[model samples]
Target: MNESMEAGMEQYLTAGAAGAVAGLGVAVPLGAVGVLVLQQAMRDRRAGAAAGAAVAVVDAGYAALATAVGPLVAAALAGVEAWVRLVAALVLAVIAALGLLASRRPAPAGTTGTAGTETAAPARVFVRFAALTFVNPTTALYFAALTTAQGDTLRGGAAGAVFTFGVFAASLLWQQTLVVAGGFAGPRLPDRARVWTFRAGYGLVAGYAVTVALPLPAL
Candidate 1:
């Protein structure tokens, strides 16, 4: 999948092989998210605490959009998210690299999370997703474009809105929780384990990029 310019993100935005079910695939990145939460917690205990709940809120919005607009819209506009993702892999790698580098940066003695303020994970993972999903420029606008593409499908008005909300609730809750759990598990890891996890995670992400670059089916 070639990365589209909708929101500057392309690679990981595709739905699952199961159509709407594919939306849940977003949860798989919890490993990387774990690293972020762990580091954020160590820096600012508060940010880490509230991270999860915030994420759920962000996810709910995306879920709503995904449902109201319909995946078909995104599919039609982008045409094969796998291809779009393939291109976006490079962009994702850049983001991941930035995160890894920032992760390595030493915080000041009193600094906490990246934002300086911290909170416990929200009541649920979906809350975190709902709050944080749009923090990324790509996902935000891309989803909007997909929504616009719906046209008649969106005319269902409240019904469409409700459907979108249901889809979002279902998809985001399932996906965002992965990040919450990852944050909670971070501190328990040993130094060596954490390092290796980073190495392996980046390596796998890199490998995935290579695969995406190839003309293979956009899995």
Candidate 2:
């Protein structure tokens, strides 16, 4: 290959690699969203996949924004950080409450399927999950810091797009793994067990909300 082609390939590869690492860095932590994803996966694979995809898309969008203007966006968010965090905590609390209530109620007889239990329609699931993931500006801040640290590796429009795609791909891979694991495990679990499992997941989400609302002192 000629020098220009070699340089182009290297740029794409570097951006993609950086994005993959950043994606995993953000997604790997089993936070409230992660717990919900696993729980939804246990209940319905399609809904879980839909939820996961929404999260990946939002993550990618944030990554792109961060790459294009990391410092400026980060600075803008800092002014309203408290409000953003408050909104996130409240939303999470509401979701947890709804999930707990849903677990107690019997599934509509026809709705629960062979694969697992039923959730809202996949389209609704996608919007809800997307909103849940997008409300947290911390994810964007994370990518902003990462891009700043990496300097120009993620610069340029083409490089940014490739990086965003890489983030989406890596995040989707991890999210789908959780979904598949839950799907496989759901069938083996008794109905009572699954219901309790969902309850526990919601409880965790509630706890996460508390953490988000109140900052803990550094150890």
Candidate 3:
């Protein structure tokens, strides 16, 4: 291979690697979304996988946006940070309340006691999580900072595509791990344990709502 082409390939590989690392950094912290995903997994693997994919898509989209026009979005958000947080908090609070209520109830008649049975559709779950994850402006800022640090490695063309794909793939991989763990653990847990676990997950989500509203440090 020619020297210039070899150098380009190396750069693309490096960008992909960097993007994957950044994705893991973003996803591994087990925040509110992560907690919810795990809880969903315990109820139904398909639903959980759908939610996880949504998160990955949003994360990759935010990363791409951060690389392309982060400064502008950041600047715009700064003017309405409080309002944004308020909306996000309200949404999260509602989700937590609904989740908690759902946990308390039994599965609908004639259906299995799983999210797959109760959730209506995996596509719906995906849309819901995609919207939820997209509301967090912090994610975009995070990618923005990383992209800035990366300098030209994350610029347009082949590098950008590889980086974005890497982010999506890595995030999905981590989410799948959570789903698998939750799925396995769910079957083994006692009935009471399962209910309590769901409660705990929703409770954590509630806590996240409060933190987001307060604009405090969060996972």
How high is the CA lDDT of each candidate model? 0.46, 0.82, 0.82
Give one digit per residue, the lDDT tens place, for model 1 in 1-219: 344554322211332222234234443345444444444444334554455435444544564565565455555756565555555566546655654564464445554333322333444433443333444434544445555564554434553554344445545465335445555655666544555555555555455556544664444
The clash count of every prediction, one per candidate, is 41, 0, 0
Stretches > 4 Å off in candidate 2: 113-118, 216-219
Q: Could you tell me the lDDT of residue 172 within candidate 1? A: 45
What's each prediction's TM-score? 0.49, 0.89, 0.89
Worst 10 residues of 2 by lDDT: 110-119
Query: Mind giving the per-residue lDDT tens digits that candidate 3 earns over 106-126?
Result: 767776435322644789889
Per-residue lDDT tens digits of candidate 2, residues 61-93?
Answer: 899888889977777776666666777889889
Worst 10 residues of 3 by lDDT: 111-120
Candidate 2 is scored at a TM of: 0.89
Please list the residue runs of candidate 3 whose C-alpha ends up more than 4 Å from where it truly belongs after superposition. 114-120, 215-219
* Consecutive 10-residue window with the lowest summed lDDT within model 1: 10-19
